[model samples]
Target: MAERSFHVARLPGFATMAVAVFVALYLPIFTLVAYSFNASNSMAVWGGFSLDWYAKAWANEQVKDATVRSLVIACFAAVISTAVATMAALGTTRRRAFKGQTFIYVMINQPLMVPEIVTAVALMILFGLVKTVTGIHGLGYLVLAHAAFCVPFAYLPIRARLEGMDLTLETAAADLYATPWATFRRVTLPLLAPGMVAGAMLAFVISLDDVVITEFVKSGGQDTLPTYMLGQLRRQLTPEINAVSTMLLAVTVVLLTTFFLLTRKKD
Candidate 1:
C-alpha cells in the first residue's frame, strides 16, 4: 500500500514534466505557423488574416532564383551521395573488419560529428587555395561541399540494410552460374532499393537545409534559398519571409508524404 501510494504521488509530476517538454518543443513552431497567416507586417501584432504575402513571396524573382538553385544543388548532392554511399556499403559489408574500417567510418561521419564552423573554416581555406591555383569560380565547390557533407546521411541506412540482408540469395545466384554483376543487379540491387531511396531522400533534405557550408563554399552571387533567407533576416523582418517559410514547409511535407506513399507495403 505504501509503494502504491508513492507511485501514485509521482504520476502528477511525470505528467507535468511531459507537458512541459511538449510545450517547449512545439510552442515556437505553433507561433511561427500561426503568424504566417497574419495580415500585418509586424509579427508581434496580428492585423487580420491574409494570403497576399504568399502571393508576393511567390512572385519575387530573387526568391524564385534561390529556390531553383537550392533544388538543383539538393538533387545533385543526393545523386552523388547516394551512389557513393551504395558502393561504400557494398564494400564495407562484404569485407571483414580491417585496420582502416573504423578510420573510414570516422572520416565519412566527420561532417556530422565536427562543429559546423570548423568545417566551414576548413572548406573556406581549401577553396581559397584552389581558387588561387585553378581560377575556377564555379558552384562546383558548393556541390562538392554539400555532397561530402551528405555522404554519412546517405551511408547509414544503406549500410544497415546491407548488414541485415541475407547473403543466401546472392550465393544461390552465383551457384546458378550468374556473373557477379548479374547477381548483384538481379538479387542485391532489388533488395537494396528501398534503403537506397531512403538514404537519397535523407541526403537531399540535409543538403536543402544546409546554410553554413553553403555560405563558406558558395562563390559570390550564388545564394541558395536558406542563404537568401538568412540575408533577408539580417536586413529586416517581413511577412514575405514568413510566406516563403510556409511554402518551404509545404514542400517538405509533400516530399515526405510522397516518400512514405512510395515506400509503403503493398498487399
Candidate 2:
C-alpha cells in the first residue's frame, strides 16, 4: 500500500494558510485596483466610480513622455538582454560540461543573487566612471544598465528550455553531416525560438518595471514612468498615480499572459 496520507490530514490547514497568504498578497492589489476607478482623489474612501483619473493620466504630458521613454528603454534592454542570454544559454547547454561550468552559470545569474541596492550602487559608481571617460549621456546608459540587470531573468527560461530539449533530433542532425550553423538554423533555432521570445518578454517586463537601478543610473530629464510616479508621490498623493499604476498593471498582465500562452504552446 501507498504511504499513509499525512497530507490529507494537513489539507485543511494548508487550505487556510493558502487563503490567508492569497488575501495578504492580493488584497492590497485589489484595493488599489478598486480605488483606481474611484472618482475622488482620496484612496482610502471611495467617493464614487469614475474614469476621470485615467483620463487625466492619459492627458498628462509627463506621463506620455515617461511612458514613451520607458517603452524605448524596455525595447532596447529586452533585445540586448535576450540576445546575450540566448548566446549564454547555448554556450552553457549545447555542449558537454566543462571545467568551471557551474561558475560560469553562477556568474551569468549574479544579478539575481546580488542584492538590488548593492547592484544599483555598483552600477551607479561604474557608470559615473564611464560617463567621465565617454562623455555620453541619456538613454544609452539606462538601456545598458537595464539589459545587464534583466539578463538573468531572460537567461533562466531560455536555459531551462534548452536543457529540457531531447538530444535525439540534435544528434540526428549532427549525424546527417549538417554544419553547425545549418543544424542550428534548421533544428535548434526553431525549437528554441519560443523560449527566446518568452525570455525577451520577461526581460521587457523587468526592464519596464525597474525603478531602483533606473533611479541610480538615469541622467537628468531621463525619468521613467516609475521614477515619475515616485516623484509625484514625493510631491503629493493622487488617484492619478493609481490610474497610472493600473495601466502599468494592465500592460504587465498582458505581457505575462502572452508569455504563458507561448510557454504553454512549447509544453
Candidate 3:
C-alpha cells in the first residue's frame, strides 16, 4: 500500500479546534461591530439599528484630527520602511552567501523578536535625549519610531519575494550589456512590485494600529487614531468608540484584502 499523506485537518478534533479558535478570535470583533450599530447609548442594551454613532464619530473634530494624523503617520512610515526594506532585501539576497548573513537577518528582524514594550521604552529614552539636546520636539520622532518598528514587517515579504525570484532574467539582462541599475529598474522591480506593495500595506496597517510605541514616542497633543481611541476608552465607554473601531476595522480589512490579492499566486 502507498503511504498516506499526513494532514492536520484530517485529525479527529481538528475541525472542532479550528472552529473554537475562530470563535474565540472573532466573537469579540463581531460583538464590537454589532454594538457599533446599536442605537442606544448603553453598550449592553440593544436599541435597534442606527447610524447616529457613526455620525457622531464623524462629526467629532478630535476624531477627524486623529484620523488625519494616523493616516499621515502611517503613510510616511510605510514609504520609509518599504524603501529601506527593499534595499536591505536586495543587498542580502542578490549576492552570494557570506559571513554574518544570518546576523544581518537577525538584526533586521530584531523588532519582531524583541518585546514591543521594550522597543517603545528604548525609543522613549532615545527620543528624550534627542529632545533635550536638539530641542526638536515634533512629529518627526514619531514618524521615525514607527518606520523603524515597521521595517521588519516590510522586510520579510520583500526578502521572500527576492529569494523566490528567478535569476535567469537578471543574468540575461547582464549578458545583453544592461547596467545593474537598468536591470533592476526594468526587470527586477516589476517582479518585486507585488511584494513591495504587500509589505507597504502591512507596514501601514501595523503603524496605523500601533498604540504602545506611538503612546511612548508622541509629544503632547499628538494623538493618532488608536491613541485617541485609547484615551476615549479611559474616559468613557461609548458606541461612538465602537463606530470608530468598526470603521478602522473596515479599513484594515480592505487593505489586507488588497494585499492578499496582490500577493496571491497567479494560476
Candidate 4:
C-alpha cells in the first residue's frame, strides 16, 4: 500500500468552512461599502445609487482637516518607526546569538502583546504629566505614541528580510577591502529596500487607522480621520460617514496590496 499524504484542503468541509469564515469577516465591510453610494441618508435603507455622499465628504472642511492631520501623523510615524525598526533589525540579526535575545524581542514587541487600551492609558498618563510640567500641548504626542506603537510592525518585516538575505555579497565586498559601512550602503541597503518599504507602508496604515492611542493622547481639536469618524458616529448616522469609510478602505487595500507585492518572493 502506498503511503498517503495529508492535506488540510482535503479535510471534510474545509472549503465550506473557509468560505464561511471569509464571508463572516468581510460581509459587514462589503455591506458598508455598498451602502456608501446609497442615495438615502438612512444607513439601514437601500436607496438608489448616487455620489452625493462622496461630494458631501469632499466639501466638509472638518473632514479635510482631519484627513490632512491623519496623513501627516501617519507619514511622520511611518518614517520614525521604520528608521528605528531598521536599526533594531540590523542590531538583532547581524550579530551572533546572544544572551537575553528573546527578552529583547519581547520588549520590542511588547505593544503588540499588550492590550491597546493598556498602552493608550499608559500614554495618556505619561503625556498628561509632560503637559502639566511643560504647559505645552500639540500633535507631537500622537505622533510619538503612534511611532512607538508601529515599531514592532515595522521591525518584523525588516528582520525577516535581513534573515533571508545572502551574506555572500557582504563577504565578497569585505574580501575586496570594502569597509562595513561601504558594503552596507552599496549592497545590503539595496536588498533591504523592499522590506523597508513594506514596513513603512504597514506602519503608515496602522498609524492612519489608529483610534485608541490617538483618542487617549490627543489634545482638544486634534482629531484625526478615524477619531473624527468616531465622533460623528456618536452624533449621527449618515451615508457620508460610509463614504469616508469606503475611501479609507480603498486606500488601505491599495497600500496592503502593494506591500504584499513588494514582500512576496518571486519564485
Question: lDDT scores for all predictions?
Answer: 0.87, 0.92, 0.95, 0.96
Off by over 4 Å in 2: 1-3, 8-12, 265-267
Candidate 4 lDDT, 1-267, residue by residue in tens: 234777788899999999999999999999999999999999999989999999999999999999999999999999999999999999999989999999999999998999999999999999999999999888899999999999999999999999999889899999999899999998999999999999999999999999999999999999999999999999999999999999999999999999999999989
Write model 1 residue lDDT over 1-267, tens digit each, in one string. 776565743765888888899999988877777788889999789988998888888899999999999999999999999999999889888877888898888887888899988999899999999999999888788888899899998998888878878988899999999899999999999999988998888888889989999988888889999999999999989788888887787777776676566455555
Q: Tell me, by lDDT, which candidate is best.
A: 4
Encode model 3's per-residue lDDT on 113-134: one tens digit a residue: 9999999999999999999999
RMSD of every prediction: 3.3, 1.7, 1.4, 1.4
**Model 2: how far is 96 from its true place, Å?**
1.3
TM-score of 1: 0.91
Error of 2 at 67 (Å): 0.6
Clash pairs detected, candidate 4: none
- Could you estimate the TM-score for every candidate? 0.91, 0.95, 0.96, 0.97
What total of clashing residue pairs does each candidate reach?
0, 0, 0, 0
Q: Model 2: what TM-score?
A: 0.95
Q: For model 1, what is the error of residue 200's alpha carbon versus the real structure, in angstroms, after optimal superposition?
A: 0.6
Tens-place lDDT digits, model 2, residues 1-267: 256646654665888888899999999898888899999888688899999999999999999999999999999999999999999999999889899999998999999999999989999999999999999777899999999999999998899889988989888998999887888999999999999999999999999999999999998899999999999989888799999999999999999999988878433
Better of 2 and 3 by TM-score: 3
Q: Model 3 segments beyond 4 Å from truth? A: 1-6
